[model samples]
Target: MAGFLSSWPWENLGKYKYLLCGPVVAKVLYSRMEEGTFKEDWCFHISILFAVRVFHHLFWSSFSNMLFLMPDRRINHQGYDFKQIDKEWDWDNFLILQALIASMACCLFPTFLESIPLWSTKGLVTVMILHVAISEPLYYWVHRCLHRNKYLFTHHHSVKHCSPVLHPFTAANVTFLESLLVTAIIGIPILGSCVMGYGARSAIYGYVLVFDFLRCLGHCNVEIVPHQPFQTLPFLRYLISTPTYHELHHKEMDTNFCLFMPLYDAAWKTLNSKSWELHKKIRSSAGKEERVPVPDFVFLAHMVDISAAMHAPFVWRTYASFPYTMRVLALLGWPITFVITMMMWAWANTFLISCYNLRTKLFETWAVPRLGFQYFLPFAKEGINHHIEDAILRADQLGVKVISLAALNKNEALNGGGTLFVDKHRDLKVRVVHGNTLTAAVILHEIPTDVKEVFLTGATSKLGRAIALYLCRRRVRVLMLTLSTERFQKIQKEAPQDCQNYLVQVTKYQAARNCKTWIVGKWITPREQSWAPPGAHFHQFVVPPILPFRRDCTYGDLAAMRLPDDAQGLGSCEYTMDRGVVHACHAGGVVHLLEGWTHHEVGAIDVDRIDLVWNAAMKHGLKPVSSSVTEQQES
Candidate 1:
């Protein structure tokens, strides 16, 4: 019976589970339409209550994620996984159930149906008194019983305990039975005030707001309340629960069972002795002082487009846990993303997006407040560079060892492949790296060693030039496709005299029809791809990867590397890369920081260091995703 009651009746409805509240919503709307004006009625009040609760939960969830992005501010260093996120996805079902019960109560009781005043000081005081005299103790004992009773704990209360490291949504992540008990605790106080003839609409609103505020505060996983108040007046610690205090309860299940106050825990000898000390320590660590630790590495990245914005860790954790793909349902969020994009474009600056730990080293990802399309605008170049420059300077001031430029931030046209900053700020201590060395190495390693001839596009670009030079050094025949004879010969001349003949130049796609190995550094159309013969494989480094046109050919993903097994706290994917994998350039930055090399890796890549970087990466446990062109081959 307990197990049966634990599951919601509408649980199997999936996305349509919201229809459980449809009847109440329809009644409220119909009332408004028939009367043509708002009224102080049961349906109207219930609708408002539901909306307010929804807003409260959303506000805390978003606020908590904002704090989570800043590694120093997080109290619980353990990261949340997709399993926990999916488990808590239905946390708000309790709110809907509570509202439905309130509607049913209004129909059964005449006192609840009576018109009530919006505000009353006496009513507010009565609600607080009743809550202290009744709700707090009742909840304390009920919670204690749930924990002490074997059957109840296993069947009803254990679900909420699954997420030991709390997120804001964890507050209401309870079974139906436990939610009902919580509703009773909340309703008893308000109903007691009404029975005593001191109830007001304001009392109900105030009590619920305070209840949710403390619940969310306790589970936010960030120590927000300072230690000064407890120092100034020690008695205040008994009256309120801190995030650290609640976290201790989660960590040590047998202690700190109080709902919103430590007074009960104190009386029952359930308080953890280290709560106050741990709170002080966490607060001191996150303090804005000179002693705060700076990240060793920063991967400076930006959003690709409006659709990609939704994949941000803070925006939607579940969506970001996997490799990104275009979903039709994601179209619903475009309006909200558009408004945010406009705001970011107008006034935003560089900000931290996410972070993780690789052994003892701390790595972070920071975003420039710009999009993929914005990077190409004629007038936006200077502004984009300003943001990037500010981020680089800021990282330097904070003692950051290395900052890698991702995607368009390394555009040759924008900041000359990050060479502008390195040349302008010659005195800076932090190494500014384009990280294209490892990118070139990863691409070059993907080609089969036995291949004698290869066709290359975008042969004159930075990565393209490096790949061409490295491949030519091995005495392989290279068919470089470019219209510019000057730029083609410029790169050809850099190769050794023996290998210069191997770097052959071609002007049209038709020239590559006989070659089976195609390295695409530039986007090619279906028409251009049709020039390749059967069984040809396309290895690419282009953004927004080219379409797989031919059924006979296979296409490879962008250059990426899987992080070392020791990498920790990485719960979100990097753009379209698989879990625990990052773009090759991002891994290059990590390698640079771990190796403690003093030289800046900005501007043009050096052909000599291609094999050197690749060997170093393998030594550090970073594995290339594409080991060979044959591995990516598909039917």
Candidate 2:
């Protein structure tokens, strides 16, 4: 989605030339994937992985969804917000896992002569069975102790419960030391028994190998491993464990200890079907709490590299540990930054050469083309996205006229429902150049005549500064306005050009984010709600109180339209032929309107604190679209 190509004339015929760079991009990305888990060629791999996982589930076990609350894998009763220990009641099975790993390693390594080898198939099978026997009973007892003895807290069995809510990958995080101890205890005796040709048989060795892989597959954090590994054969049911069965064991630690079967837990009457219900409830709550704020991973990646670089340059040692993950990332990240930054520098240079004051207009317009929202582009830059997404939401909610102030290389003016195009004014005196089809969007919208002239080309905060200056000089009523860098720049620039003498007086007055709003606030921020200019009572036109809400505020209100009892049925008798501008207002703002023409929405302004108009001068520099500026500049 970030791979957006702007729809513009000059943007073509460049290094970013979309056609020729595919092979080069592919090679660079593929090479990075070979080095580590962070694969640059992830688009295809992730899709393949997802497909494999889904297929595994269809042919696998019988769980409806992976997030099914079960005792074994997840220990659903535990707190979902915090990590809980795994309850390995089936110690024998876990021991079997350790034994299998160690036995295979020992067999592979000849240097470990002191280690007895389950080198033969028969020997391997004998050792494996023995391991299953010894660990199984011990675990059953320990498992009982965990619940029966209050002294043994859950943490002791922590590793067992890791993926309380299991997917396929949850099987690997077992504690190393705990696994080692189990391996040593089970392995030595098995090897000793395998004296001479007493090592494990080939069949048994194969079983061990398959068993290890299945154990991991069964306890995965995802349900991609299929519902049942041994499908269509009841006899081979024990071959690959299902998440449902194993997950129950972890969660219901007091039960399911005997290996290769749930028969033990059932015969012993330790497993309860009702516990499944509790498991569901717990994980459900956890899923709710899973709403994590999206982190700025891009920024985080940069910091990691910068820190590693700083430390390495300071302390040099003879033996260098592997480069920090951050350092490696920095090396990769710098190239991307350089490529992007250099591209920006080039664009700025080229644009300046092509057009001077019009550069900003072209650049902005080139990003979001006029009326392009009619056919949604899924790929767009983050900045343009924020505006478009919000715009889309507003458009679909309440059809609107989206007037964009950009210089497209086409006809000077264009118009569409929910779309409008504004070019730099060739004749500044008119302030607005109405085309054959273009409706007055920005320059002609609900803004006052004098303010519209004042706000000509500025962006958001610049418009606000312009308004402040004009109001101060003309001694006009001022209302609320937004504060920020744009406001600062506009005041700095427009004040000298327009409001010089009253500059000192204007400097005494400042705009801030603290504005009061209970109206059309969906598109704005908290600061806009809070720091509104002092006394010009800032009330939000949260006019969109209902779902079909179009523009954060409705331009009209039904409550205000109720006619008085004396003025009933004017349509017939006398047809109280009245019509200039019918404005029905309440204490807050506009409620309804009946006139030859109606304006935007019902928003009350004290007219005391408001300035003349916004000076959007800083929009050229991407300063925020000030709240007032956003309100004022429609087209």
Candidate 3:
């Protein structure tokens, strides 16, 4: 048999070379795929499959690229990304490195466990329990060092930070060697478990896969858990870093360290000690950080952590450009974990489209000059749009008050006066407010004598139109404040017929963000609010009234502004906010409500202070927090 085999081994080898070869065969298969030589499935199904694959690649690839480049902020090919300025910044690098050094024992320690002489099954069980008890803590300490030390962070674990803005693919952004290194550190206990024969190899594999998946689950860029339980769960965080479990690692400095297991942290007190307090504090302040009303850094951080964790196991499910006979599912011998996969997919898809829209806003907005393919992507147009004429008609019909202010903003002040006042007046034909608008509008002395009631309806812009609609009611008398236009515009062509058309008189005047006129005065004879009589019962509310300042604002250091705010609002309130980050509704009469900043924690300031702040915001003119910020998917 040996002689016969020796003679024909070469023949067998040649015959099955195609099966045995590696990348070369893969390349050949890939080529056959493009040429249609494989004679695969029918054209339609294949086309659908290919399209899905291509889209998936692009989605994941771009997401990964953003996740990596955004966090590192090296100013490479993608230009400037703002994710670096998020809540915690990149804090995991240091922890993982420390884990690496200690992880060397991951391989060696297990050997020792295997070598331990054993006889009693009860003793073996005791030792296994001991191992479980000690294993996580050991891993915890190592993991903590990786996060806390800078040297370890830079050399060993820095890649994770590349995805400052974590995405699904970004989970595997770390060097493959580093992953192995991490596995090794944690593997020590796994090996010990196997060596002791307390748990079978299958158990070890389950532990490893499950553990790795948890680590990733914690790293997903999106938050998948509620703070209610995980929000309150302590000690266990270090044992197993859940979605929120890992996000804190990315948030504050030297705060949360436990990953995949929290017992060690509980014992050593290294777990996210400050997280609950900060979360509660912020939430109590606004009530909404917990409400999950808007997308914020916490949401982004959790998403990345989860995505990364889930990604580690499925490094490659489909063949790499090869038309292999069959594309194997990710799990090799293990039964399918469709539930887990579906859960990941469910969480992932929920926010994928939202993130895509957010990330691509610039392209869509800047492409207004181009029409080729950009038109198909409608992400940029994110809100209700109303024209100047239509707004006045709505005012006349809906009874919304229009309080047209008297002055042009700084931009228009640079231009000329008549153009600001009279020109828009002729265009709008509405009686504009004929008075001087002073800096201290909340003081109310700047108003003229005869005005009866002044409602700070929204601006003449699209967002303003929507805001005004929200404020106006059928029975109420409302004076519309806007850049005067000749015709009444409709909010929607098929808008419901307003009930009381008698009380509202729409007034258009060049207002904030688009004054187009220089210093406005009654003498200009062109565009004045014919509606805001000299003495009016009035109030002011800002448009997009979420943020405290503007995106391009430069008053002082603004904590590395989340520039081009995802959803921000700025205004010179009618008055001052007695306190910062509010909770209860303003006790004051006039308050500026930002578009997306719905809930804030209650503070000591009198509600009147909030009202004044809201008024001041309105005084500053109107601007949305994010012009492109529309309703988005969950963070």
Candidate 4:
């Protein structure tokens, strides 16, 4: 899907070649059991075969159609503005028609393979060439005629032209007549070639794969084809059909009608000028070079290198630790208590350093820094709160619409599970968010549908309790770990009797037996790896994971957010704490800002609004990990 061959001409080949051609190459070596490479069953029915084909198309098309909703996996880097896909969900009738048309092709092609042999390399190549040779001119003329004819244009062809922008799914969005016409154009040529004894079964499949691949590519709106060859070697300009080339045909409505190859368009003098220029602009060795505008929900971040902060210089260490020692001495009535009190007063009365701008883009963020030791120090609470408030006020002054309090900032500001600070400061222009709703949502979404046996640590916490209830409702067996049996009983008693059967109460991690999926809440900070199950997939809610993942175990943080089309932008960029995107709590504030931008009531978002943030996150390239672990490598 990244790139193909290494040579100058072939290196430009994209996923189309791999997706369309690789299968043909594989099939040639090991022909299927039905192709007489193995025992043939006389009981095999053609209707069953046709039904299989229909179901195959239905399943794959449904899955591929949903891929548009995920930005990271998208073929095109440009994000879709309108949620046309949500509208496309009602296209069940169109899918049926598509399946019928594909099934009909299956019947004509390999099902009638008495005379035709399995396609060799030459046979497959010949079929593809003939298909392009025969179909292109006829398709061009017919398609142009449909556009020129007012009645047909308005009723049939215009259905496709209605979408000025094209997408992979958009290739299937055509009227019934248009779909039939396209199938006929493609089918007639390949079937004719097979009858002439120049084609094989492999060729038909290759043609089908190529047909879908090209249509999908033509509509992808992303111009992946390099312009260097066309620019340097002028004669090669007419050899290929680029995304920009087809897009021009959509925009202008009277040119570049050739499919796959641009030779016919050049001959007919219908090649678009704008497409040539666009190709030149994006013709670098790396393809696209432009930096997209930073998304509105940009993550505001700061470094929290625990190891570095803990080992600060002597003066800074003394500055941080002195207050705690003096407080202890004052409590104990140690000598020089008066002097210690005065020093403590001086420390408390010191002016705040204040948070300031660290990064800028669609949203700006002011970073607040503190040594890791400061969080545990006696003077830390007041200082941390002051910094958080300062950051919020600074963000508001700087015109930041929303500010997400990341990590301990959330802890200090919210006081470990209350919204009093944000609630009290209602008059501020900047909206503050903890971004936990979607974090919980992301974790819940990652739990597999087939998951039955589950282990949840810190089940007494808000997030753990919510997840336990959710899993119980799904009737999945849940092992809930808490500090005591009393809290476990409290949760168990809260559930309906019907759900009680699926709930297991425990006070220790070792009691969680045979559960493959482990949801470790913020409260359960297991220092040793053996505390978790062998080969377990750990979902850590904290930024720096509480448990060090075992060699066999997979781990991820709660910071999973996506960007547009997995575009080479902010989300994928390497950062200090984690290499990829920041935590969801950081991005959560961005999501809240985006919610407000869309005119939704936005403030401190709750778990109920997860869908809104989740949907918006995907649109902007927030990739959803199947499990709640944000820090796992995408395999």
Error of 4 at 197 (Å): 2.1
- Model 3: weakest 10-residue lDDT segment is 362-371
How does each model score on lDDT? 0.86, 0.31, 0.32, 0.55
**Candidate that would win on lDDT:** 1
Each model's Cα RMSD: 3.6, 22.8, 21.1, 20.8
Model 3, TM vs. native: 0.32
Candidate 3 lDDT:
0.32
Tens-digit per-residue lDDT, 251-336, candidate 2: 66656554444434555777546433443443343434232111100000011122332222112110012222344535654665
Task: Show how many residue pairs clash in every candidate, following the order shown.
Answer: 0, 85, 125, 15
Weakest ten-residue segment in model 2 by summed lDDT: 294-303
Candidate 2: which stretches are off by over 4 Å?
A: 1-147, 153-155, 158-164, 167-181, 184-215, 225-231, 235-239, 258-263, 271-325, 329-635
Residue pairs whose backbone atoms clash in candidate 1:
none
lDDT of prediction 2: 0.31
Collision count of model 1: 0
Q: Select the stronger candidate by TM-score from 1 and 4.
A: 1
- C-alpha lDDT of residue 41 in model 2: 33
lDDT string, candidate 4, 133-230, tens digits? 77887887788788788777777666566553465556666666776677688777566776776766567656666676677666766555666778
Runs in model 1 lying further than 4 Å from the true structure: 1-12, 29-44, 68-73, 77-79, 106-122, 148-164, 195-197, 226-233, 274-287, 325-348, 377-383, 426-429, 549-552, 595-598, 615-623, 626-635
